[model samples]
Target chain A: MIDWSIIAEALPAFAEGLKTTMMLLAISCGAGLVLSVPLAVARVSPHRAVWGPVWLFTYVMRGTPLLVQLFMVYHGLAQFEAVRESFAWPALRSPWFCAWLVFTLNTTAYTTEIFAGALRATPSGELEAARSLGMSEATIYRRILLPSALRRALPQYGNEVVMMMHATAIASTVTLVEITRVARDVYYNHFAPLESFGVVAVIYFVLTFGMAGLFKLVERRALRHLRPTASGVA
Target chain B: MLHGYLPAILGGLQSTLAVAATSLAIACVFGILGAAAKLSASRAARTVAGVYTTIIRGVPDLVLMLLIFYGGQIAINRLADAAGWGYVDINPFIAGTATLGFIFGAFLTETFRGAILAIPRGQMEAGQAFGLSRGQVMRRITLPQMVRHAIPGFTNSWLVMLKASALVSIIGLDDMVHRASLASAATRQPFTFYAAVALIYLALTTISILGLRWVEARYSLGVRKVEFK
Candidate 1:
């Protein structure tokens, strides 16, 4: 029932779409990871002054739909004459920039929460030991807390990355020619939704499982110390 | 111009709610069945549910929506033609609702399965010792407690589903997002319209959070609240 000819014709387009999808995923996730580290640290601070605004920011970002956020950055911004005439207009007008900005902001909010939870779960004894060693709060955080929290946060962060990859499909709504967009274009051209979307589905399935497998490998290595020895009996 | 279109945008909220509510009901059905299948002794049933959750979670909702709406339409029509039943037109409402329900059902499967597993094994055994039928045990001992445990995950899924309802507009469901786009186009003020819609969504989520919190409290009435040291 599937159209092989259309699939053959669309192979190159799908490959290009996959490249754009990966680019979007990489840029947004990389930026989100960098931004979330400090935000997550701030989120766990004892002083409300340090954490209140960050909490509010993450709350709003998490509460709203990412699609609305994308629209606000993309179609919404271009509505204003002042913005259109501003120095940042060229970047603002590009769909790629808008998608990247939204995705980064979106993932940062989520990852910050993940990291904050991990940070909160750090053993009190470890913190006490650091303080007993005459380490300053800065040193304690920099040298000990953040690293351990990040290690604990790895699995959740891996899930976030895979989610971000799936979320990049929404970028296609803004005309960013990602995998979903390619599928839509092919469907329109061939009027063969089965063939067009089926191929796209396979590509996404492979990417999703591939990501899951990679994370599994990373977890195995990073968490090796925690694993029980082969000869050990519980 | 936006002032004139405000009513139209507000009207779209009705459609959005209808779709969300209907899909949520359908998803609950799928979730229960999925949980049952997963917990069933039959290997085939377990595998079927496994594949359902795997495929649904692996694919993006938009892709699934497009496939079901467009592809399902063509497939149904082709079947109809062969069966001498001319021109079967699939409604976007049905397609959108079914796809959303189907997609979220996979998530709910996990939530429901986890909640069921959280119930103590001894509780079921105790019910059996009391000579309660399996159905009686499920209803009396397992299901009520499951609600308390399921609420948090259910709330998370519901909130996400509410936000996801915006996606229905892509398939021409005339939801809030679609209305906002129309208003934006007509008013030449995309920012105003989009921002307005976003605010409405935020309000919905906030209200939902409060409502779900109340439900959680009600369900946890007799449960001891552990005070963290």
Candidate 2:
């Protein structure tokens, strides 16, 4: 039988670590969206010039491992004295910032594809209607295009968000002290794998479950018009 | 510098590939067994399969790698001392491979189980009616179909397994990442070493993605006829 005392002992530290994990998730996902929005639009550019580099950027980021990418920015960027002297040095100097930056770029690659796919899948009739109404490009994007594209992308985007939460566990590689890091510390201190990892496992499960539930809520809200009344009530 | 770079990275690549190959083979074998156990009627089998997947899946690869490698070392040293084996030292490479293989086996278990379930029940029934032995039926009909069904999920997991292989560096394995870390530390040209590592990983993944897609197409060859709708 597993001892409950170990869990009780680890709870406070785990909670603090959970806060940092959430911070990483929030910043990465937020920054990812900001970066992806332009990239998505650029990817669908009618001209090859805009689309080519955007696609390559997404591909390279998507193709590589997050840990390697984080290390590249964190340790790699410091190699260049020019980069060290550059205005961006201070931002890159911080491990936390580098972790977030790497994660942001990684998530951006995934989100750009998701959002771009959503944009392409937006109803042709709707686009035709928007143009027929003489709506400007900005107005069409703001008023009609993005909203429907977002609605279509909500479920996939939710899945991506949950995956990111799990991926952030790797942030500890850069010494972020997230939930996984705390678990490692506990394991080192007590030399008890089952007890330490068990606590961390529970925290991860709870977070994953909570994120899934939140995604469900967002999905329902996005598809409210499409859902049956009985479905909504339930 | 450029002359030495490719050769050193290539040596790391060979080692990384060797580890990945061994682990992937082990993972697939376990995947089959676990998937079969998951679909077994025995409650014990189901429980074991479920627990194996849940615990591994919930934990990240790096954490699992550390725990298993360190824990195994401690456990083995104790056993060796008690048995007078005279100070056995476990290799980091073996530990890293075992960790990746074990964790991925859990994932592949689910993929294989889901694939087996998706097979039409009537096909198995038809095999039984033809007076085929259970083994014969499984070999000819069930296993092949399951492989086809398992391909897509297997591909995704395989790609992921490659990336997860990077964690071996932390355990002091002289894979590409470890070599890069050392190279950067020795040269103080962190950008050059890590950028080289990242590019190598990207190259491997791009090639892997294409290869997996080809395998998927191969497995999916005869099964594309029927539409679900």
Candidate 3:
């Protein structure tokens, strides 16, 4: 019942779509990881003046749908003459820029929360010991707290990365020829849902599990110390 | 100014809520069955449930939705043809809800299974010891206690599902997101309408969090909190 001809014809387009999807996933996740570290630090800050705005930003971003956020950046911003006439308008006009911006900010919001939760769960004794060692707060975070928290955050962070990969499908709505968009185009042209969407679904399923397996390897390396020693009781 | 489009947006909000609520109910049904299957003695049932959740979780929701929408329509029509009935058109509402229900059901299955496992085995044993049937023990003891453990996961799923209802617009359902798009196009104030829709979503989520907290508290009435000094 599957149409091999349609799948063969769509191969090049699907290849292009795969590149776009991967680019979206890689760029957003890379940038989001960098941005979220500081925001997460701020999120767990003791002072309201420090963490309050960060909390609000993450809250609003998390509370709304990423699609709405995408539209707000892509379509909504273009509605304003001031924004359109501004120096940033050229970049704003590109769907790539808008998708990158929205996906980065959206993933950053979630990653910040995940990291903050890990930070919050840090044991009190660790902090006390760092203090007793005459380490500065900055030094403590850099040397002790962050390393531990980030290791603990790895599994959840891996899940977030997979989630962000799935989220790139939303880029299709903004005219980006990602995998989902390619499938949609194929569906429209060939009237073949099984060949079009089915192929894309299988591709996604493979990519998802492949990435999950990769994360498991990273966790094994990073979390090795937490595992019981070879000579220890089973 | 909403330019008299506020009412239209509000009307669409009703549809959005309807989709989320109906989908949640359907998901709960699937979730319970899946959880039971996973927890059952039968290896075939466990494997089926395992594959169901793994496949559902691995794929993107939008991909699955479109697959269900277009793919499902074709399937239904072919069945109709075999029965000598005319072409069958699937309603966007039905397709959207079914797809959302199917997708979120996987997540909820995990949630419900964990919740069931959280209950002590002794509770079920004692209920069985009292001469109650397994079904009666499950209904009277396990399900009630499971609610407390399930609330947090359920809330997370619901919020995610609520936001996901926005995707139904892509399939041609006139949800709030679709209405906002219309209003934005007509008014040429895209930011205003989209931002308004976002705020409405925030309000709904905030309200849900508060309401579910109350439900959770109610369920935890007889439970005592552990304190560490």
Candidate 4:
């Protein structure tokens, strides 16, 4: 029932699509990670001024659909005369830049919440010990809080990564030739759903499980301390 | 400002809600069956449910929708050709809801399974001692309590499903997103129209959260919390 020749012909396209997908995933995730740490720290701040705006930002972001966010950045911004005349308009015009900007912000909003939750869940005793040691606020945060919270956030953050990866498929709507876009093209050309979407489904399956397994390994190492001992005490 | 298309965009909310509500119902049906299968005595049922959840969860929703939409159309037409029937056009509404329901069903299966498992096994045995039938035990003893445990996960799935309904526009369903695009194209105010739609979505999300919280509280009325000092 399946046609091998069509998939064979589409292999080259899928490879290029895979490259685009990986690039989008790597850039957005790396940028999101860097941006989310400080945002998360600010998110947990005692001062309303520090945390309030961050709360609003994450709430708005998490509330709306990512596709709408993408449209606002991409098709929405171009409608402005000022944005068109601005120097940054050139960067804004590229689909790559728009995708990167949206995906990073989207993932950052989610990661910030995850990391902030993890930071909130940090053991009080750990903080007390750090403070009693005369550690500076910055030092305590840098050395103790961030490390433990990040280790705790690893699994959730891993889910965000996989989610963002899957989300890159939406980049196709804006004309980015990611895996989903490639699959769509293949489908339009051959009218073979089994050969086109079926193949892409397998590719995404591998990507999803690959990400899950990678996170499992990371959690094993990072959470080794929490693992049960030989006597069954955690 | 929605540039005189406010009503048009707002009207699309009907379609959006319809899609979300229909898909949610379908998802619940699939979810219960999947949960039952997983908890069944037969190993084959468990394996089938396992594969269903695994494959469905692993794929992207958009890909699945497109697959079932276009792929299903072709498959049905082929069957029709064999039966000497005419062409069948699959409605985007039907296709979108089916795909969303199918995809989210996998997630809810896990949620439902976990919720059911959270109940004490002794309760079931106690019901047996009381001479309640297995189905009676399920209905009277297990399901009601499961609702409390299931609420948090159900709320999450609903929120995700609500947002996911926006994707139906991609398959040509005239959801709010699609209406925004049309308005944007007409008025040349893409930002304003999309922002309006975004705000509407945010409102829906906030309202859903509050509503679900009330539901959760209602369900948990019988449960007592133990606090650790």
Candidate 5:
């Protein structure tokens, strides 16, 4: 039988780390949603200049690994004396903020694609009907387009969140004391790499597995109206 | 600093491309086999294929690469020792390629399986009616359609595998990312080097996307529906 006692004892520390993970996840997701919508919109904008920067941003972010991007933002760009003198330095200097920054941008690249695909999937019929009802272009988009695209985007956007959550483990490389860092410290102290990592792994597993379950529930809720037979049966 | 390191980074880029290309070829074999296995009626084969994909998908690629590069080599070396074998060594180059090929094959398996499923069932029946052998039916009827169906997913996976080829640098393969890291550290120009690295990756991906488009056009010519431009 396995030792339940160890896990019980480790619960508090694991919970603390879990909180940090959740906060970082939230920051990345929140920032990502705000950033990605504009990028997605710009990506499909008719104006060349509006979309040009968006294309370059998405291309660079998507092409490179997040580890390098994190290094670039936290270590590389910070190397400039001018940047250090800038007001943004304090925020950039903080490891948490920097990790969030890199993750936010990374998510922006992925979420831009997801949102663009979702926007493409939005029903044209609804848009035509809204236009015929004398809705202004901006109001039609505001009330009709945004809500519909958001609903379409949710499932894939959720996957982006999960990927970012997993990506957070690398933040420890830049000296952020997340779960991986804490586990490394414990491992060095105890000389039991497997045990320490195992403890931390359980926390990560619980987080990801729980998130998966919750997302499935949300997916079912989102799709319930689409399932005519199931809705009628229910 | 840039001039000094250009040759070294260029040398590393060759190895990165070599490993990715070789692994992708190896993965193609595993992908076909895995797709067939998953589609087989045998419960055991399907279950095995499912488990292989599940484990590969759940584990981080870096962690899997580390395990194979280190843990796999240790096991191989120990087996060699116990057998009193000599003059045989586990090469990281071979090991890294195999590990990446193994991981990416699981994804390709999924893609190929989906592609095979997407083929209309009647196509095979029609092939049979034309008196083609089973082999001919697969080769002439199914494989072409599967390739067409597989292109988009295959392109996405190829792009991902190209980026992931960087992780092998951790296991001591002198890939582009590894050389770039050394360059960044030595030059203290992390942003410039990283930005350059990003552009190189973009160039590779752009070239690959163009190649994929050519492949799709060639393969899809007979079946694609006409649309007004």
Candidate 6:
């Protein structure tokens, strides 16, 4: 029932869509990783003054749906005459910018929480030892806490990256023509849902597994010290 | 304009809730079956359950929703034609709920399986040794404790599913998100409607958090709280 010729014809569009999808994923995830470190540090601050607004930001972002958040950025913001008149309007009007902004913000909130949880769970004895060794608070954070927390956060962070890749599909709704949009276009044009979506499914499956495998390699390298040695296993 | 559109969006909230509730029910059924298959001794059951969870977890929900809603409709029509049944139309509600249920069922299967595994095996063996039948041992010993262990993961899945219900709007389900879009178009105030919908979602998630906390507390009644530094 599947037509090979239709898929062959649609291959170029699919390739273009895949590029857009990867670009969106890379930009959003890159921004999210950069932004989340400081946000996560702020999240675990002892003083409410430092953490309260950060908490509220992550809470609000996490509480709502990503699609609605995307809408608020892509479609909602333009509703305001002031926003339209603002200097940011040019960038805001572009669907790619809005999708990137929304995704980066969303993933940052989630990754911040993940990193914050890891930070909080850092063994206090290590911090106490650092203190007794005359390590400054900043030194302790930079040397001991952030490194360990980040290492611990790798698995969840990897999952978040995969999720962000999947989430880029939503960009299609705002006319960004990502993988899902290409599949839909193919389906409409060729009247073959199976061939159209089936191809996209295989693409996504490969991407997802490829990402998982990459993260697994990272884990093995970064976490090699934590692994039990062959001699120690006995 | 916000006041005028409030009732219409609220009506859509009803549809959204209905879809969420129905999908949760279906997901529970699929979860139980999946968990059973995973935990069973049968090789085929285990392999099938493993594959179901892996594929569902790997793909985006939107892709799966579109695939099932569109492809399932076409597949059904083909089957009907072959059977001389004329034509078949698939309801978006069924397609949406089934897809969400099927998708989240994989998550729930892991949750339930982990919960079951968390139960001490000795308890089940002791129950059996006390002359309790296998069914009685499961019902009396395994199930009750599994509820306590499962609550947290179940809550997580439920919250995720609640947000995911919004995706159904893309499949022409007339959910709150869809309504908000329509209202945005009509009122020419996308921010107002979308913000309203976001607030509604926040309210739902907040209430669910509170409710699940209560359930967790009720189930943890006899357990000691661990104080960790």
| TM-score attained by model 3 | 0.98
Reference contacts preserved by each model: 0.76, 0.57, 0.86, 0.77, 0.25, 0.81
- Residue-by-residue lDDT tens digits, candidate 3, B34-67: 9999999999999999999999988999999999
lDDT of 1 by residue, B202-224 (tens): 89999999999998999899889
Q: How does candidate 1 score on lDDT? A: 0.92
Clashing pairs in 6: none
lDDT of 3 by residue, A1-234 (tens): 998999999999999999999999999999999999999999999999999999999999999999999999999998889989999899999999999999999999999999999999899999999999999999999999899999999999999999999999999999999999999999999888999999999999999999999999999999988889889954
When sorted by DockQ, best at the front, the candidate numbers are 3, 6, 4, 1, 2, 5
Better candidate number, 1 or 4, judged by TM-score: 4
lDDT of 4: 0.94
Residue by residue across A6-31, what tens digits does model 6's lDDT show? 99999999999999999999999999
Two-way TM-score contest, 3 vs 5, winner: 3
Candidate 2 lDDT tens digits, A1-234: 456777779889988999999999999999998888878888988989999999999889877888889888888888788988999888878889998888898999999999999999887899999999999999999999888887888888987887788888788878889988898888788777666775676677777778778889988888887677865673
Which window of 10 residues has the lowest lDDT sum in candidate 6 chain B?
B1-10
**Comparing 4 and 5 by DockQ, which wins?**
4
Report the C-alpha lDDT of model 4 over B2-48, residue by residue, as the tens digit. 55787899789989999999999999999999999999999999999
Question: Mind giving the per-residue lDDT tens digits that candidate 1 earns over A45-85?
Answer: 99999999999989888888898899988999987889989
Compose the digit string of candidate 4's lDDT tens values, residues A1-234. Answer: 999999999999999999999999999999999999999999999999999999999999999999999999999998889999999999998999999999999999999999999999999999999999999999999999999999999999999999999899889999999989999999999999988998999999999999999999999999999888999866
Name the best candidate (by DockQ).
3
lDDT minimum window of 10 residues, candidate 5 chain A: A187-196
Global local distance difference test of model 3:
0.96
lDDT, residue B130, candidate 3: 96
| Better candidate by DockQ, 2 or 5 | 2
Report, to 2 decimal places, the DockQ of model 4. Answer: 0.85
Residue pairs clashing, model 2: none
The best candidate by lDDT is 3
TM-score of chain B of 6: 0.97
Q: What's model 5's TM-score?
A: 0.88
Deviation in Å, model 4, residue A141 alpha carbon: 0.7
Q: Candidate 1 vs candidate 6: which has greater lDDT? A: 6
